[model samples]
Target: MVRDLTALTTDMSLQEAVRIFSMTRVTGLPVVNDKQQVIGFLSEADVIGAIMPRSRDMSGIFLSDFGEIARKMGQARELSVGDYMTERPVTVTEDINLSTVSETMLMERLKTLPVVRDEKLVGVINRTDVCSKLMEDREAI
Candidate 1:
């Protein structure tokens, strides 16, 4: 139900993905193969995970480790998007209903879902794009 999905390859550097995200004004993109099949998803969170440092989640120390954890987060960035992205990601078909797509994304905690046809990546649908459409459904916010 969604189209015009931006995609990337897992072999690409994380920096490249971040550059794409910044340049495209999209928070995330789908990771596909040479055949253009959905392989994984590269998201802002994944990018953050790649750049963010790996540290002990001391979220319970000093009466809640939020500060300590944040301190560690400041020094992270030792991985790549290929290292962070889930190897096996969820996929969808172009004929899938809009409600189904939306539900799957929300329920699966997905940032983007590639639209495939006969196992070929055709386009992408993302929560941000979907939400943007739904926002117009509202009379007022």
Candidate 2:
């Protein structure tokens, strides 16, 4: 797990979140409250989905011109992380076993999981972290 992790606040704007994502090169980040408690998660997918036009038909078809796309993106930029973040995100405790962590990631189809202690933000575990630890354990055996 990465002990040095970047966290977002609920009130942060989507534009700021995008900037953070670009700077950190992370696909997702955990959102925390003022008490540093994990509350939600924001991902690139969430941001993109927020700006994209939702399909109105059962066939899942939609059309938008560049102007419409730009307008939606402008609106998204004014929104806060809370508006699009996944609330009550799946998280792991520090004591969780590696297998359980891996299973959770797979089951949720998540690339990252925030590690919490006493409901507070602590660190994060990514797919690479799990795979590397597994490989090291195998080599040690």
Candidate 3:
């Protein structure tokens, strides 16, 4: 079972979440509640969308179009995770088989799924993790 994981709480701001994602270079995280119970999830894509630069209606081609996008990005505020996190994300137990994981991911197109035991968060399983496992298995062939 995979063990290395980066966890954060729901109360954490999107700004902080983005900071952690940048610092760790990860794409997703488990959102835990006040009791340290896993409650939701946050993705880098969502965070980026939250701070996405607005498109300007510069019908006439102007050299300053790029400048406007930059200005909009700069003016964007430090958003909050609670405003964007996906609540009650799909999860699985550690004892589940790889086939089940593959089925859920394929059906849901999920990037990652938290591993929970006894209603508590423990680790995570993601596409990257499965890819790593597949590579390792092939190497053993």
C-alpha TM-score for every candidate? 0.71, 0.91, 0.75
Least lDDT summed over 10 consecutive residues: which range in candidate 2? Answer: 57-66
Kindly list the per-residue Cα lDDT of model 2 for residues 1-141, writing each as its tens digit: 899658999889889999999999899999999889999999999998877666555755345445666887877668899999999999999999999999999999999999999999899999999999999999999
Writing each residue's lDDT as its tens digit, candidate 1 over 20-108 gives 88998887787878887777887888766544444535652353445645654553333355677877778887778767877998899
Q: Would you list the clashing residue pairs of candidate 1?
A: 51-77, 52-76, 53-76, 59-65
Candidate 3: Cα lDDT at 60: 50
lDDT accuracy of residue 37 in candidate 2: 93
Better model by lDDT, 2 or 3?
2
Any residue pairs clashing in model 3, and if so which? 14-81
Better model by lDDT: candidate 1 vs candidate 3: 3
lDDT of 3 by residue, 24-59 (tens): 777889888766577888998777665554453556
Q: Residue 58 deviation, candidate 2, in Å?
A: 10
Please give the ranking of all candidate structures by TM-score, highest first, separated by commas. Answer: 2, 3, 1
Candidate 1 vs candidate 2, lDDT winner = 2
Candidate 2's C-alpha lDDT? 0.90
Instruction: Report how far residue 27 has shifted in candidate 1, in Å.
Output: 1.5
Give me candidate 1's TM-score against the actual structure: 0.71
